[model samples]
Target: MNAEPEGLTGTIAIQVESDVVTSRQMVRKLTRQLMFSLVDQTKMITAASELSRNTLVYGGGGEMRWEIIERDSKWGLRLAFEDHGPGIPDVQLALTDGWTSGKGMGMGLSGSRRLVNEFELRTAVGEGTCVTITRWKS
Candidate 1:
């Protein structure tokens, strides 16, 4: 895990071996701690699990950062997954549901994007990939 600065409130970080089962468990634990509506929590958990698996399988190994956001009575969760592996060469095609660089079913990225309220991805051929997902309570 990278060194994080002090006093990062409402933040949780977890590192899992480059394995899908462990990654999914990590995401499930985090999602359970988030104070979101039932539906939103389920959606975000599924998305986070998928992204976590992708990071482990495709990006060698990575870490996930989770933060809680609260505004008035509304609450949300923000998750960021960063990986240092063979970066995506063509992001556009990768975003397409049926397209994949590996032997994956090719639904991870696009499916996760659809489940989140806000999604952002950054990647380069040699550089790593960073995926940020936010889900808000409604």
Candidate 2:
């Protein structure tokens, strides 16, 4: 993550499955604007897609916030997915591989973590959940 101040780039409302696709497209566009390689762009887009889906499906709808960050001379894209739905009862279990409470493959959180440069998860049992991820251009 960068020590420099981050500038909010955009936000996408995630209320439906189509919003997940929109999030991915927006992230891909941002990554390309930052001159990220194709692989990096794909990684961010994939992570955004998964997180956005989680927000809509599990969180019952929320939003995705994005920022353009600078660290040293390099650029990065940061995304945060938030929802006010029922939060995970066990954060640790939710993060484990192949552990899902829904029909998903249980790769949304853990897999997104592996695809980005930074990963963060915040949740309250009855409140909601927020997952943040960052991918630095290489």
Candidate 3:
């Protein structure tokens, strides 16, 4: 993502299933405001949904932070999901497609990374996890 978050764009807590849904809705609205294409909107919503679910389940719930960033003349949406659950033991293995730590298809990490222009994952055992991703408006 090219944009730098400037203001309070939005925020959602991933404590339950409903919050995950709300997170998707909020991102959809933000993407629309940024004039994201339909495809991009879908990608963003899907990515948000996946991250939110991950937080609720594996991370034992967390928070989702959204920001409408601006860089130079470009605009983008940035999302940061944080949790203090059992941090990922092997970040690299987790990023491998179809490699799951639990009962899942294992796309939550790698797939989400591919759906956006930028992806960053920070995790430590017993510490927490934070995954930030961004998609610039094209």
Task: Give all TM-scores, in the order shown.
Answer: 0.79, 0.92, 0.93
Model 1 clashing residue pairs (backbone): none
lDDT of 1 by residue, 1-138 (tens): 122331223333334543456545545555555545577767887888788878877887677776767668666677888888888888888899888778988988999999998999999877789999988767
C-alpha lDDT values of all predictions = 0.74, 0.88, 0.90
Native-referenced Cα lDDT, model 2: 0.88
The alpha-carbon lDDT assigned to residue 52 of candidate 3 equals 92
Candidate 1 Cα RMSD after full superposition onto the native fold (Å): 5.3
| Candidate that beats the other on TM-score, 1 or 3, i.e. the better one | 3
**Candidate 2 deviates by what RMSD?**
3.9
- What is the C-alpha local distance difference test score of candidate 3? 0.90
Model 1 local distance difference test score: 0.74
Q: Rank the candidates by lDDT, best first.
A: 3, 2, 1
Q: Give the lowest summed-lDDT range of ten residues in model 1.
A: 1-10
